[model samples]
Target chain A: MSVRVVVRTFSELCITVGAVIVLFVVYVLFWTGVKADTAMDDQIAQLEEQWAKGSASAGPGDPGSARGPGAAAPKAVAYEDGRPFAVMYIPRLGFTWNKPVLEGTRTKTLKKGLGHYASTARLGEPGNFAVAGHRRTYGDPFKDFPRLRPGDPVVLTDGTSWFTYRIDTRPYRTLPDDTAVVDPVPEKSGYTREGRYLTLTTCDPEWGHSHRLIVWAHLDETQPVEAGKPKALRR
Target chain B: MYGFIWRHLPGNTWIKALISLVLVLATVYVLFQYVFPWAEPLLPFNDVTVDNQ
Candidate 1:
């Protein structure tokens, strides 16, 4: 090819590549957020429908919550992989800020909503209930993660009960391999005993994952759904 | 690579440019709806878990 033609072709290729990169950015920032918001809404609707079905089939004396205080604790529902079982609300994020919590931390599972660490304890249990969410993309569920502070409450509901957990520490940054942050008693969480705790993790630096930001919380109180919103959730 | 496609168009320059623009828009749509979702799992930047295993 002539030198001028070759130069034109090279410049054209560069321009096309640049356009593609810009399109990719748009896909990540705008399109993915739009899609994730819809997915989260669908998940919440599905969970609500399931819960309604569950309650409709049971008698008045059922739901375990109607039982006396000295009775056995409510049985935890088995969380299915990739399925949403709970909705978490963080007032610190915003009054309208809520996200469905799905089982498993797989990449696909997280795209839809926050994912629970399958190895961690189930919600409201006497162990660390760990969860993960994206920091910058896929709706940026934890985009304001750094705003979390000690004493802030994270409320979650699993159809039958509302569990409120109060933050125990500010955001803790560590490498992704520091799996101990989700342990029954997280090493850095400053807890010396087992308890009903919540661990929230998201990627650090907003745009990168070289590190993680963690917020640890302990169960403050739990009440049956029929009791209205929990004290922490009250306006 | 793009030069071949531009040369093979069966129309004059203006028509070829219009067809190229349509093709580019179609490619972008395909990339967003299918290619990106498929390729996203293969990338690690979205990972937020401590135990990747």
Candidate 2:
């Protein structure tokens, strides 16, 4: 072959190979993302449905008969009872990690709730019921946590009973520490210390963990399973 | 602009088809291998925990 013709063929071959690689990368980055998103959405929706049904292990009982002002019903099952204490549904962000939320952060519990402080307080108590969760790993359970706003429901069910709370605040300015986030009552003057509350804590900045994100809510209402059931479980 | 056309030249039909095929295979492999596994845990996976272990 002539020198110029040989060089031209070699150049075209290089171009064709490079184009193939570029196209491959684009398909991996773009189309792969599209498919993953679709699959994740469908799976989340299905799991949310499963969460709506009353837990398989929950025995029939009147869950809220004992609940008075700041009174919690007898905890039917221990944190390790394998019964899900709460049905954490975040519709806006599409989260339905229905694993058992351990009441204490043991090695096993922390693995699920990220971390737990037993000394802090118990649920529906006067002190902090502090819990933590990983921001990125382990299913990224609370990755879209920042999307939570005031008035979102945080539902907690103790197998036989269910409790509902409304998201009260997302305070970024309270303090650099986690104490205020999990505090039982308002440290400030205007806030009342009488109502039952639920606080959710997770690592902040979405995938990045520069700080902690605290989502707090107050008990809106409660009922035993025989009385009023959550709309998700009604069907 | 001398180097622009040199970089932008279209390939022959056979080369173009080969390039597209490689792209499709690579995409399929990535979706099945890395992306699918990383995203699977987000879905329900038969509740295997340490207690079960």
DockQ of each: 0.55, 0.07
lDDT of 2 by residue, A58-162 (tens): 444453456653365554334432222444444445534333354454323433433434444555455545445544544455666777788676665543456
lDDT tens digits, residues A44-121, model 1?
999999989877875454644463311224555588999999999999999889999999998889989999999998
Can you give the TM-score per candidate against the true fold? 0.91, 0.51
Off by over 4 Å in 2: A1-70, A74-87, A95-99, A106-108, A113-116, A125-127, A171-176, A186-190, A232-235, B1-53
lDDT of 1 by residue, B1-53 (tens): 68889999878999999999999889988988898887766655586888874
Query: Candidate 1 — which residues are off by over 4 angstroms?
Result: A59-75, B1-7, B11-18, B39-44
Alpha-carbon error at A122 in model 1, in Å?
A: 0.7
